[model samples]
Target: MHRSAPRLSRILACAAVPVMLVAVGCSSDSGSDGKKNAGSSSSGTASSKPSEPTVEPAKFTDLPDPCTSIGKKTIEDLVPEAKKKGGTAGGSTDLSVRGSCSWNGLDDQGVKGSQYHWMDVGFTRFDSDQALGSGAKRATEDYGKQVTKTKATEGAKKAAAEPAAGIGEEATLVTYGLSKTDEDFVYATVVARTGNVVVTLTYNGAGYAGAKTPSSGDIVKGAQKAIKEAIASVEKTAGADASSPAKDDAKTDAEDTKKDDADAKGDAGSEDSPKSKATPKS
Candidate 1:
């Protein structure tokens, strides 16, 4: 038995070598097939990598707080007898994107009559959507609808919509007179757009008892000032510079004039060169 030990060892070694080789071969084949399958799937699969849609980023990421957008003094002047000095916050589904502040006062003079005034301001912000449109563009579209709706107020009289300047990119002033509660009411709505934000200022007043009806001119002037403040607030919230919109327009106009002058000079030089280059006919 001692003499046959080497022979048994050799036989065991030979048997183990074949089994190891077979196992290795199987593993190699499996690995190679897996790599091929992976490569094929990568090339043939339609959704190897998904792409995300891109949209233009809005100029303003958020809207200003409606209650604080206008100055305290402005509100005080507009609503002398306002129930809330801070202005009444309108119900809002989302305060970050949309909000409103309103003020109303009914000044009673007993025999002289009472004066009723209501002033409210609202801010709506639009986000840049790939499927819908850019923020500025979208706001412009909504602005038209808002103006039309204001003009079509049920009992509005002498309704007039005139293009407004110096407020925002574009603005419309809708002024109308209405008779409600047996008193004459003056209404002025200014729809303004600043960047991606739209501002709507609705102000109406009626003298209840006998207070002389508020002047439409006065209402419009107040609305314009208030709207300017609102636009400035929006710009501040958006991190924009403190430049007035009127200054921006003036700069643009100056640039246009310079370009026109340069163009005119180029045309004049071209005409003079042609005349100088032309040889005198014999």
Candidate 2:
């Protein structure tokens, strides 16, 4: 009976070895599957990352030359016009007008920037009774108010000067100027007239240095020229003689009415006109 008990113990030990082997094999398979899934998740995360946005650079060829298009009239025209209207046009750089033109500049970091330049012109007509004085007064007041409002803003460091008088009540020209804020860059020049005519020259870029911001005084100069050309165009379309016919006619009618009343008082024989008479008796 003792020998049979020893043989039974050895059989049980042999069966335990296979059970342990099976458990080890199952654990190995589970670990291999987990690794494969982790690798796949890592790869997917990498693929899902987003790319940065791209910025397009401005081309210099996009702008027109103000000199050839606008002719001799340029922002320089403002000098004499302003003086004539008892106003002054003064700034650090001498401006020159050019054709549709674009250029590149640089920023503090040496990053490339771009500029667009353009011109706008406008005009308005008033009767002789309106008085050039009245028109000039309105323009000066409006320009002052605009400058005040602009200076009140937080980021705007400077305010534009009041516009100078142009060619009297028959025509007035104003210029709009834009430049890059990050670096000293010139953007564009727009000219606006009283009667709602406008011409604009635009320049755009990444930084001022790229457009040679320090050197390209063209932005202001071009604007001046465009404004002059626009003013000239407006004058051509609405000649001085015909510019304020409405106001002149109104003034003439008022004077005629005064003269007629004086004459009627002097001559009792003259009866009141039907248009001016009260309603007839029933």
- Top model number, TM-score: 1
Q: Write one digit per residue (lDDT tens) for candidate 2, span 1-282.
A: 999999999999999999999999999999999999999999999899686443222111111222333443343332222212221222312122122222222223435443322222222222222333343344444444433443353343332433434532332222233344555433333333332222233322223345544333544444545555544544454222342578989989999999999897757645555555567799
**Candidate 1: which stretches are off by over 4 Å?**
1-55, 238-282
lDDT of 1 by residue, 173-254 (tens): 9999998767889999999998778899999888875689999888999898888898888888854434579998999999
Count clashing residue pairs per candidate: 4, 53
- Any runs in candidate 2 off by more than 4 Å, and if so which? 1-115, 118-137, 147-154, 158-184, 187-211, 214-216, 239-282
RMSD, candidate 2, Å = 24.4
Please give the range of 10 consecutive residues that has the lowest summed lDDT in model 1: 235-244
Prediction 2 global C-alpha lDDT: 0.41
TM-score of each: 0.65, 0.30
